[model samples]
Structures are given as structure tokens and as C-alpha cells.
Target: MAKRIIKAETVQITYREAIRKAICEAMHQDERVFLMGEDVGRYGGCYAVTKGLLKEFGPERIRDTPLSESGFTGAGIGAAIGGMRPIVELMTVNFSLLAMDQILNNAATIRHMSGNQFGVPLVIRMATGAGRQLAAQHSHSLEGWYAHIPGIKVLAPATLEDARGMLWTALDDPDPVLIFENVMLYNMEGELPANAGPVNIEKAAIRREGRDISLITYGGSLWKTLEAAEALAREGIKAEVIDLRTLRPLDDTTIIASVAKTRRAVIVDEGWRSGSLASEIVTRIVEQAFWRLDGPIARVCSEEVPIPYPQHLEQAAIPQAEKVVAAAKNLLSK
Candidate 1:
């Protein structure tokens, strides 16, 4: 058989071009790979990430599923079991709950339950976090909930590179992987490497460095925390920002090192304060670096309420740059 090649000229060439590249590259590299989800074909995905893909790969490879979350989700799991690589896109994580059994119980457990005999090589992409005022039904950061489960990988791609690189990595793994793209980051522009380089699913990336404090976060909160750090600089406070790229592996090493140096930490998460990954991160610092603490741990999290329809209220419900700044200052004061 002749080897396959994707012409560099074929790239989409835009801010979200990398996402399309990731999908295209995977589909081109492996004949087993295909995409299935609501509006993934003719509609080009909810955010158009899969735009033009159906045309290029054709409908068989780029399948547009029905509104039935559980049904199509279950179908994806079955296809993966039958030796096909399926990238199943849930319009949003909120809708994925209806298919929870297929994901949490089926896709996540098949490998372990079979004593590693049968595995699910499935990649599920979903929009996560609050922004654009989609309200409670459409917006929810449920990656944390999924992270709590075993036998699956949870990824939060905060940068353009990860947004492009993660899909290939996820598809290669023998187990299921969930890629959560923050709605707020889809259009954000950044220079992606000519070649997305090797990415690890077990490590965290430190987005910024400083000594006064550590702003630990991931996904949508990363931008806000970095902005807050910039604002704190004028006051002589240097804040280090860490992005927890893989929520499941929970890179405590990187987080502990930063907190150990700064002696103070503030976790900014879009999820509510209680029982959140933010709380888990703070607890880790307290457990590993409590003696080095210069102040009580602080957190800036979304308010405990269902997302609202009004734009301003939705803004108020989630963590913002100003709130991050205030939280950083409060930690500095103690």
C-alpha cells in the first residue's frame, strides 16, 4: 500500500486551523480513524472545529449523529470496541450527562473489566466552562466530575498547541480520553509550533514564573490568572501561573514546586468552590507545602449557582480577571 501524506498547503490556515489540522492529521494517518457527533458533518460542529472535514474525508469518516446523546455515545463505544478509532464529539459536556452510563460505565470500564483484554480507543471532544451566556443547560465544567472516574484520561487544552496536539495523543492511546475545550478559548489566537511536538498526558505546564505567589489553574481560568498576574506586577508582586493540563494525572510535582518557592498559592477555577478540582489543588499544597506557607491558601472560583442567561449575570457567576486580582491581593495580605 502507498504511504499517505497530507499536503502542508491543505491546512485550514486560521486561529482554529490547528484543531482542524489535528483531526485531519489523525484521519489521514490512520484509516481506522473517523469522527461522529451531532452536527459534525454538514453543520461543521457547534464551533466549526470540524468544518470542511466531512467534505474532505466524506460522510462515512465524518458522521453527523442525531440528538440522541446516549444512543450515539453508546454507538461510539461499540465502534471503538470493534477495532475502529472514533472521535465522538458531544455538542457540549452538559449534554453528555444523558450519556453518562455509556461514558462513565461503559467506555471507562470496558478495559479494566475485561482484564485489559478489551479496550476502548475512543476520543470524546466536548465544549466546557461558562462564557457566551449559554445558561445552565448548555454550559457546565463537568471535566472535574469525569476526572473522578478511573480508566479514562481527562485533558484540558488551554493553548492552541494543546488544542491541536491533544487529539492525536488521545487517539493513539488504548483507552478512552476526554478533551475539554473551553468555549472562551476557541477563537483566541496564538502561534502554534510548525510541528506540534511530542505531548505528554501526565504532566502540567507552567505558563508563567514569579516568586510572590502561585496562581494555579487550567482551562478558561488560565487567561484570567495570567491577566491578574500582569496587574499584580505593578505592585511588585511576581505571580507564577501553572496550567494543570491533564486534570486526571494531577501533576502535583509542578504545582508543589511553584508553591514551595512562592510560599503562597491561589487556585482559580471556573467550577464552584466546594468539592472542586480547585479545592483538591489547595489541599495538595497544604499537605505538601504547609510549613512553607506565608499565608492562608486562597481560591477564586465560579459562584455556586446555575449559569444564567443574562450576559452580565453569567459574567458575574464565573471567575473574572478582577476577581483573580482581588484574590491574589487577599492572599498577599495574610
Candidate 2:
């Protein structure tokens, strides 16, 4: 029922506002769409993404649930099965672990368990990653762990267009979808396309193309990778940057194609180094494009230690531009 946006006009927006606009657009288009989460109505969201939504949409649609993640998550799943499109927002990825039973056992399984008689068209949005010095309580990035499951789609939107578009597309999905917005990206400012609309959720996007090596990454790490690419360019070492917008399905074709051409890869992820999404991408490259590799695949990931509260320690624990540049250089030298 929504009309395509006209591309003649342009606007600058923050990542938080883009997501809020997408939610507003979806609710306006579909009567069944609603948003609910802790402090989502009155408190304006943990990151202020829903600042005015409660007043605009009213109490019924912009519900403010109690502090129980498991309780509201299960409720959202039930509501989705009851012929309503519900976007449930958890404050952080660490909080989502409390609702793993509902997300993994219920929302992701209803379609197959019921012989295709029922589907859970739920959209769960949460802030993920570290850089805020919020310690382990709120700064962990576990979206990769969620990617290990069979059902549900995992999306990480690193740009303004994606922040605006992925939400509506996720709402339209028949199965459950999880959108992970990096906590640090909420305040990031950028120019969005005048008529930015739904983007393809099935493929990886190449931000910068080069032949030397592929800088494979997603989420907040994309910008750092891009920065590293520019720095490498100065030294005459071209690096291709691949943004993996979707994590669960892992765009194997695009990834393999990029690796096959570059013949080398360095994955940057905010998740832990061991058994992370970076590891998964590296494994895929080894399986499909092993012979294409001119050197061992390099990975820049967060250290295995807990995210510290101090600024310096937290920065050290997370992947940075310098580390990515070093990783790229090491791969080329090999």
C-alpha cells in the first residue's frame, strides 16, 4: 500500500532517525504493524531511536513493556502468529540471551514444526557491538551466534539507506527477521538517497573494489574497513571492501566471487575471534576458493577478553582501523 519514494529530494539524517522513519512508514502502511519494547514508549528508547514515536503512534502501538526480555519476546512471537506484524526491540544483544528460548525454539521453528500451516512474521531489532565503554553488560556483539541457527534472517545495516530500508523489508518478510543495529552507529550522520527504499536483503555489497585483497566485514566494522582500504590505497595496495549486509544466509556467491578475484581476504568483525562470523566466512573461503588464495586468510576481531569499562581498555578490546590495515599488510606480505 506504500508508494515508492521520489528520488528528486535529498535529506541528511542520522542512523537512529532513519530506523525510526522506517518504523513509522511501516506502521502507516500496514494497520497490523506495531512496535513494543522496554521503555520504547515513554523513555524514547535506550538510544532515543523512538523519541517521538510514543506520542505519534500513541500508547496502543508504541507499547512500553516491563524489564523482562524473555516475557516481552515471547509475547511478540505469540502476537506475530496471531496475524500481527510485531517489531520487538531488545535494548542490547546481551539482553537477547534471556529470550533465546523464544527466539530459537519458538519464533524460528513454527513454520517447519507446523508443516507450513503457520509462520512467525516477527521483526526483532536490537543494538549490538562495543565502543561505548558500557562494559560487557551492554556492549557484546553476539549477532554471529544468532546466525548459527537454521531459521530467521540476520541483517546488519551500516548505512543510512540500509537503516531506513531494511526495516520495512524485514516487516514484509514472512518469517522471523532480526536486525542488529550497532550501538555506536546510532549517532552516525550521513546523507541518504532522496528516495532510498527497500534494498536487497539477500546479497553482499562491495563498497570499494580492488584486486589485491578483499576486506570482508559488516555492521559497524564496515567504516573501519573502508578507512583501512583508503589508507592502503595510498601505499598502492588496493583492497576491495565487501559489506555483508546479511549474516545468517551469508552471501556465499558474492563473497567467493570477491575472494576469487582478489585471491586474498581479511575479515574484520566486532565479535570474538574464536567461532565467530569472521571464522565462518574464512571457512567458506577455504572450502570454495581455496586455490584462489595467494596467502592465508587474515582476520581482525575483538580480543577474547570481556569488554572493559575503561575507555582505553575497551578500545583495545575492539577491532580498530590500525589493526585492519596491519592485517591487510600481513596478508599481502605473505
Top candidate on lDDT is 2
RMSD of candidate 1 to the true fold? 5.4
For candidate 1, lDDT tens digit of each residue in 211-250? 9999999998889888999999978899999999999879
Model 2: what TM-score? 0.97
Quantify all predictions' global Cα lDDT against the true fold.
Answer: 0.89, 0.94
- Pick out the ten consecutive residues of candidate 1 with the lowest summed lDDT: 7-16
Q: Write the per-residue lDDT of candidate 2 for residues 142-244, one digit (tens) a residue.
A: 9999999888999999999899999999999999999999988999998887678888799899999999999999999999999999999999999999999
TM-score of each: 0.94, 0.97
**lDDT at position 139, candidate 1:** 83
Clashes of each: 0, 0
Top TM-score prediction, candidate number: 2
TM-score quality measure for candidate 1: 0.94
Regions of candidate 1 where Cα sits further than 4 Å from its true position:
1-15
